[model samples]
Target: MKDFLSLSIANLLNEYIFVYDFLDSYDLKLKDDELSKSFREFFDSLDEDKLEEKGLSIDLLKEQFVNFMNAMTADADTIEELESITIVGGVNKYGEPENVELTIRKGEVICIVGPTGSGKSRLLADIEWLAQKDTPTRRQILINGKVPDKKRRFSIDHKMVAQLSQNMNFVMDLTVEEFVRMHAESRLIENADEKVSAIIDEANKLAGEQFQANTPVTSLSGGQSRALMIADTAILSRSPIILIDEIENAGIDRKKALELLVKEEKIVLMATHDPILALMGDRRLVIKNGGISKIIEVSEEERQHLPYLQALDEKLVSLRNQIRNGEILNE
Candidate 1:
């Protein structure tokens, strides 16, 4: 305890400079307090030789640093969440008025179905961007029944949404671990080793072929790429609402991807054409003529057949793989 109490800033600079960013984000400045003052003075008169002579250990420094940070940022609730998002009536593309009013709560999944150019993506964009009658759809979005402010709309750090678009192309030449590392570090997640491992594990569950940390991002197939991003978004992204557009286009496991996000208690809004994908939602909106024509809550009768549908989908995927491998079908 004496050695820990006497830990000098020189030791921290020499060995634990990586913690500087974490400290800076929480504004953990040293001042008149005994420990902070001592640390401040030690830093002011940093001496490498004296620091070593004092027998200060990196473990002690980190322990003190963590305690300081935890005390600094302690809140009744650290996790950010939205109670619900409500979309009020907005104008459609034909300059006609839409009479749609829908509310989506946390842990609920909603699917959007429409033909091409029918405004499914527009509705999603409205929810994501928090449209205040500003975009093409002229939609009014509310969070917890009130219009979201400009700070909530523009602040990237406090983002309310995460999107998984149709394409999952990897332009970067990085390993899987490196890519997850980049994202984890950006959020400054504590215990990265455990978190990264959990993310990789969850991603592997959704992908047909398991990929390791050393796997090159560019070499990952479409499904693997989508699965990786979905896992990353679910595990790391602070955004409570996750938007998926045509996820089946990436050849991802539609149910698992939806299940992953839904299980995380995130509000999932997806625009899809596949019946299997659409039926998975608790409720779905059907759009026609650039307006939400109807909202249908999925019945127990539909969910009853999901197991059969899942088996059929899996078999279809197997057939697809076999055909791609140049195996001929037997009639």
Candidate 2:
């Protein structure tokens, strides 16, 4: 009866929540009414006699929440561990086939857009299996149209899918030069040192003059961190596919950063709620209730409709550069 009740509750939760897979993929524990009950019970259990007259402060609560989130992600050491990647329309146990099927080509950017609770992260996870592959619920992952052997070195093959989460962090002790160099050192190419130096130079070019390669990551603003992460991932990666989640939240010159990624010719698959990021992709796949509701090529007409001011700004940049370079300005 206990087993049956547990299964019943799980089914009920699945039926209502819609995107239970997304929550589970991100390790976000869903809170139902039972969770409220549990919180209440725990609060009640605290000995009133031992309790201080003062209630819990907001600071204390915030600290506790931060601690909780960190603890949850403690085992997530590398970027790969955080990826909950999945392919579209993967086979599952329910005997029901997935309706959404997407074949992402190499050296292209595919943006995924959907409403809230649309299982975007799950889709990311399915395509890029990360640190938590040890569990029973594994991604039905495939690479280059073949099922990769799990027993083999997954990290090497996984280089194909570089996932950038919303929140990026770095070791404050390492300078930007040192940080990028360390990642570059791991490559197997001949003259690796020279290649590393070139990568750093390229990354710096994209990052711009204001942000120094020697600057500590701790001093960086949210926007700067995002830029650095992009540089690091873009330069160090030999990956064919890059997965980004809610990149618009980084509060940076997102268009410039995205332009750099696109220019690199890497196959980018971003999960974005922002239409601006959505427009950056060659194609947009809209997911709903764990299925693809719409898969459309971003036509030129659609591209023109997206905030025209940004395009105007790019045009102005070209005009100014042409004037300075003394080419088209005279014509």
Candidate 3:
């Protein structure tokens, strides 16, 4: 509170729009010269009788302003800072114990691999729900080694997990810049315009074809839409755990997208069938019959093959671009 009092009124209003709104609520206005003065100095100069008439004193105003700021920013302070997520053993379709205990840490990529309808999505759902042996799988999810409280598990305001499904579509009529700006503003981000620009830049880097900020969100193609959401989820979302269901078919730079998410120190759990993507993970969870069947660590031997796999992937991307351009395949 003392630190806040020392800040110039202009600085406070510029850095925290809430401060401006707080002053506006009380119909408080300052002269241009007063903007450079510290809020404490300005308040000290106010007429006591006038303040009393408004049912306010210097101490009361300061107290109420602090409380207002706290209420406005409470969600930002309470967002969970995850260290690791633990998945305790659960049962399979046959009611057999999965006999698995996996702990995934921040900045670690864990891949989920299995045939379609073999429970990959179920595992993601379990984590998303922060299951406490309640779901049919009987799996338990622990955050930072302890079971998350009901508030953290059920509160929609502060989610610990952000899931990215295979399909991404936008129905909004807003332009790309407007859409991203809306999300940034909702999060109460400082320098929102700068953040929005960075998000759009990163999204373009991931998309197959670049789109302008003026383009309507509904006008974006499938790949463009997926790229935008991936960028948004990576940059603006406070959720520490990211669940991606098969990004290989998104027609974007899948590896770069994962790298961006991991760079943000997020715990990434991707359900992917692409061998290159599975190999990219630090460990792979093999799901079968509605449960985790095995956990395979990415071996050094497998790590040695990524370069080759990446090269092949690049060739495919090149051929894809060539086809999109209507060029003949000479080779």
Top-lDDT structure, candidate number: 3
The residue-level lDDT of candidate 3 at 244 comes to: 88
- Put down candidate 2 lDDT per residue, 30-78, tens digits, no spaces: 4464443322233344445443444543344334534433433332244
lDDT of each: 0.75, 0.57, 0.86
Can you write out model 1's per-residue Cα lDDT over 169-283, one digit (the tens) per residue?
7788999998888788876556888878888999999887788989998999888999999999998888888888877633566678888888888999888777788778999
Which candidate gets the maximum TM-score versus the true structure? 3
The residue-by-residue lDDT of candidate 3 on 176-207, one tens digit each, is 99999989977777789998999999999999
Q: Any runs in candidate 3 off by more than 4 Å, and if so which? A: 1-74, 78-80, 249-251
The better-scoring model by lDDT among 1 and 2 is 1
RMSD of each candidate?
Answer: 8.5, 16.5, 6.6
**Per-candidate TM-score against the hidden true structure:** 0.73, 0.57, 0.76
By summed lDDT, the worst window of 10 consecutive residues in model 3 runs over: 71-80
Clashing residue pairs found in predicted model 1: none
Rank by lDDT (best first): 3, 1, 2
Q: Assess candidate 3 and give its lDDT.
A: 0.86
Looking at model 3, residue 185 earns an lDDT score of 77
Give the local distance difference test score of model 1.
0.75
